[model samples]
Target: MKTTKRVIVLAVLLAAVVSGCGEVTVESETTSTGSASEEKSAVAEKSEEASKASDSEVKAEEPTAEESAAEQPAAEEPADTATLGEKNALASAQNYLRFAPFSAQGLREQLEFEGYSSEEVQYAVEHIDADWNEQALKSAQNYLRFAPFSAQGLREQLEFEGYTSEEAQYAIDHCDADWNEQAAKSAQNYLSLMPFSKQELIDQLIFEGYTREQAEYGVSAAGY
Candidate 1:
């Protein structure tokens, strides 16, 4: 764009210089000799030809897409037609996402709880950029960081947090946990709170969504 502008400015100056020479030749034509007058006329003609050639050169040098866009007039700003309530809802949604992950349904419900109308909540959820699968994955990782859960247990927790069934399953599939290890961790957590016989502890692990093999492995690994 800058290069295009410089070329245009140089072309204009060249035209101006040629116009000045023509003006000088006009005065010389009145007082100069025939040969001298003819000489000046020839110089003026050459100058006019050079100016035309310069213009053609300038026209042949096509502007790039960016340069052509620069030549266009500034566009007007798009109107902000959203209501104040809707704007607030959008702002609130953004703030929530910055601090924590939220599914579309979860965010909509949160906005509604904050007193935003259905229209505002709808606008917020539509406009806010959230990948619900990512949100579910984050929730699963967060839960596992502080507590242990079997795969099914974690999926249930994500669903309770308003993720869809598909999103919950997606999180479970991608969470990358060994069910037996999670069951073992859960067993350890349970034992930290109180004592349990080996069979009783296995039953407890199963109740918390671990498979039978996973539950038995957990209880045996607990040194029972």
Candidate 2:
């Protein structure tokens, strides 16, 4: 009876040791799984925060539509200080210059004739970008195209048109006119108007500012 009692005690002790080992294994497995899950959740939160920061940085670097428009240059505005009368005077002078060339004084006269005051006329002339010498040249050419003129006559005509003496002389020097030919053309025109003998035509040409030699050449060319 003692031997059977000792054998039962040994079996009870072995069962207690096995039960304790099984409980320790189950607790260790549960602790490891919980630690792994916590680390995964922290990493997911960190990744999401970093993604949000990156999106914010991208938005900050871009310019808005309003800012882009502000960077453009503004257009220049027209001057508003001119009076209505001055504006109209300037416009009229510009239109006249566009169609025909004129001396400074001639332009002033035309503006005055249009009933602009002296002050307004002066303003228009001052603002006009005219080369008086060039205008004189153009006027001389226009006269020649319509009718023949001696160099002296052309110079006088330019002066009468309100060109300065210096400007008139410049036109005369550059007119490229052949005096003999001009006298001849004048003689022909006179003959077309009325008959004349050679002496009478030559005298007429001489009276019209041609040299004696030029007048004789003109009468000869007119078949006198």
Candidate 3:
């Protein structure tokens, strides 16, 4: 009977040990599964946070509409209010220059005659492109075509036409005219208009700005 009892106790202990081992194994497996699920959750959360951070950085890198507009170039400014007047004056000056050569003073006078203000006339004259010496030369040529002129007479006439003394002298120096011939022509023109004594012709030529030697040459050449 004791042997039978011992065997029954030992069998019960063995079954208990097996059941405890089974419980321990099931608990360990459940713990490992829960840990793996937690790990996966943590990794997914980290990936989502990184994605969100990347999106935020991209948004920060891009400029807004207002900032983009500010970065563009500004528009050009308008022209000055007096620009039209200046242009008109410049055009008028150019047109005047195209028609005839003029001294600076003469051009200013012409502009003034056209009813422009003194300031505007001065501006036009200052801005016009012309060589005063060349203008003087042209004036001299024009005068010689219509009438004879002594060197001094021509220079005076040029000065009267608004050329500076220096400019008038330049024209006279470059005219390539023969003063004796000019004096002779003047004498002839005077004789054609009315008869005159030799002394009277000579005196008249002198009064007309001829030198003494030129006057004598003119009277002698005219058979006086």
- Cα lDDT, all candidates: 0.91, 0.89, 0.89
State candidate 1's TM-score.
0.66
lDDT of 1 at 37: 76
In the range 21-127, model 2's lDDT, one tens digit per residue, is 99999999999999999999999999999999999999999889999889878888977776678778889999998898799989989999999988878778877
Q: Root-mean-square deviation of each candidate, in angstroms?
A: 22.6, 9.4, 12.4
Ranked candidates (lDDT, high to low): 1, 2, 3
Candidate 3 per-residue lDDT, tens place, 57-166, comes to 99999999999999999998986554455556657878977877677888878777777777777666666667899989988988988899999999999999899999
TM-score of each: 0.66, 0.62, 0.61
Cα lDDT of candidate 1 equals 0.91
Q: Locate the minimum summed-lDDT window of 10 residues in model 2.
A: 78-87
Cα lDDT tens digits, model 1, 72-121, are: 99999999899999999999999999999888889989999999999999
The list of candidate 1 runs beyond 4 A from truth reads 1-78
